[model samples]
Target: MKQILIAEDEPDIQELLCAYLEDAGYRTTVAGDGAQALAVFGGQPFDLVLLDLMLPGIDGFGVCEVIRRQSQVPILMLTALDGEESQLRGFGLDIDDYVTKPFSMPVLLEKIRVILRRRGLAGPESRLHYRDLSLDLDTREVLLAGRPLELTAREFELLHTFLAAPGRVFTREMLLARLWGYDFYGDERVVDSHIKNLRHKLGRNYIETVRGVGYRAAKADR
Candidate 1:
């Protein structure tokens, strides 16, 4: 069973998330404040974290930054802050997904399962090699002609999405749904930003844009 750390300041919300998640067959740990959340996280391993931006201390962003520095653990933020700036900031911090408050429990559960399932795909010996680029799923390590390439979690996952289906035209909307979850309702520029970054790191010739559409990794890059 995957363990989850749900950090929410409200007592009712905490119990709600905990009960629903457990009923969905996941082991859960709850933290009423950010400080307690950090402590619990440091002492134990969790498959995913449902963090709320409103907390007693060391807000969600702070905890996210700290955990990101130490591990690539998938973080799914739960915040009432629906503004684009806040959503972008969470993404910038390398969170896997962000869901605002007043979210549906069923949708939340689906998002959690999807993120954890994606995480589970990274096991020892899980790897993919295409052309001069090689990816070790377990480590989220990318290598181009044997040299390691550094990438943020989002960038890495984006790259995987393309490589996983070379030649498939993934529209911006498709990429957003696949990567950011269905609850995302912000500027589509987020996709463009990451694509630009990927092109820079993997070489401008790595991904091909289908002008007026989206992008795809040509088999030639394989």
Candidate 2:
């Protein structure tokens, strides 16, 4: 998952931002002030930073300026200020985007999505990562703990669907429809066979049977 640093002082907004970002399948770290943000920035590699302009200590512009001096990490300024000067200044500081307060959370999510995509972190060739497993869509390859995996077409598609939605149960009927299509009048038992084969190839415990439900790619213990 892509990790983001959210530098917003207000506890309410900080909580709200963290909740939304995490719900969107991102790892988030929040800084209550600009200095904390800078500290966190220096300590770790982050995919992006959401900066609040009106912050205690250094302020967002200063943080952006300081970060710009060392790295080209994407920064989006979040502020209640909506003046041309503020926007121009943020842009001048090389901030990727700017958003005023009372912003829609969904819009913020979309902006982050676009920014990450542009940065090639979530683009077409971007690899999907879960645990030590990786799926390269562009190359149609699978890597388990950095080792290459040779999978059949059916197994590949099945594992692909499961990996796409870790922890989400996929019913036999749904799998049949998705993998074999409506025209495949064969027995649903094939789903179990494929799953068994896939599990054998991928570590056996990588997939979990939901007992009465169906199957899901077990969520990795992060």
Candidate 3:
């Protein structure tokens, strides 16, 4: 499992992030301030860091600077500072990514996924398998029942998302922000359309509709 260090001062947001990240299969440690964050970071290894810029004591930039001087662990800034200057400063510090407050959890999670994958901290050349279906992340290929399955780019991504975490319900909004960019202004039904096509090609049993919620990969075959 990937280890993530979360440095934030807000209790509610810290708890929420811990729950979500743990549910997504990551091991996490929390730091309520920049000083504690640095202390914990020095005590152990971490695959990534979720930093809050407004952290009490030392602040995110200081903590980041301290860490950068020693290691290049990927750092993602989660802050209320959305201004270009703040963002530029974060980039100047070599943060892997920056996310402002009121951000989409799915989008943030996707950003973490991308950063880890890029750094080889996430499973490199990983293959996701659910029963007879397999997705080769490196090759961007999907196979069903040991046979090559052809899919559109969108369809493949949709399936990969599902298989990445079986039984995790993904709301249409979450899927939209994930597959399409967060700024996509298209209708939510576009997800339904792509899912419909994906089901038709990959077999309807592989994905399940969660009534009023959304969709999930059918539970792993027992």
In model 1, where do residues sit more than 4 Å from their true spots?
121-222
By lDDT, is 2 or 3 better? 3
The residue-by-residue lDDT of candidate 2 on 1-222, one tens digit each, is 888999999987787677556645788999999899999999999999999999999998899989999999989999999999999999999888999977766457668878887777772224678788887754668999899999987787677667766777878876775666423578999999988998888765888989999998886762
Write down the lDDT that model 3 would get. Answer: 0.85
Runs with alpha carbons beyond 4 Å of true place in candidate 3: 8-25, 30-36, 39-43, 52-58, 76-125, 180-186, 219-222
lDDT of 2 at 183: 37
Better of 1 and 2 by TM-score: 2
Task: Quote each prediction's TM-score.
Answer: 0.55, 0.57, 0.67
lDDT of 3 by residue, 53-144 (tens): 99998899999999999999999999998999999999999999999986766567778889998897753336778889988765768889
lDDT of 2 at 114: 81
Candidate 2 off by > 4 Å: 123-222
All candidates: CA RMSD (Å): 12.4, 11.6, 4.5
Better TM-score candidate (1, 3): 3
lDDT of 1 by residue, 1-222 (tens): 678899888876776676556544567899988889999999999888899988887999998998898989889999989999999999999999999977766567657766876877322234767678898765578999999999987788778767766677878876775567545798999999998998899874768889999998876834
TM-score of 2: 0.57
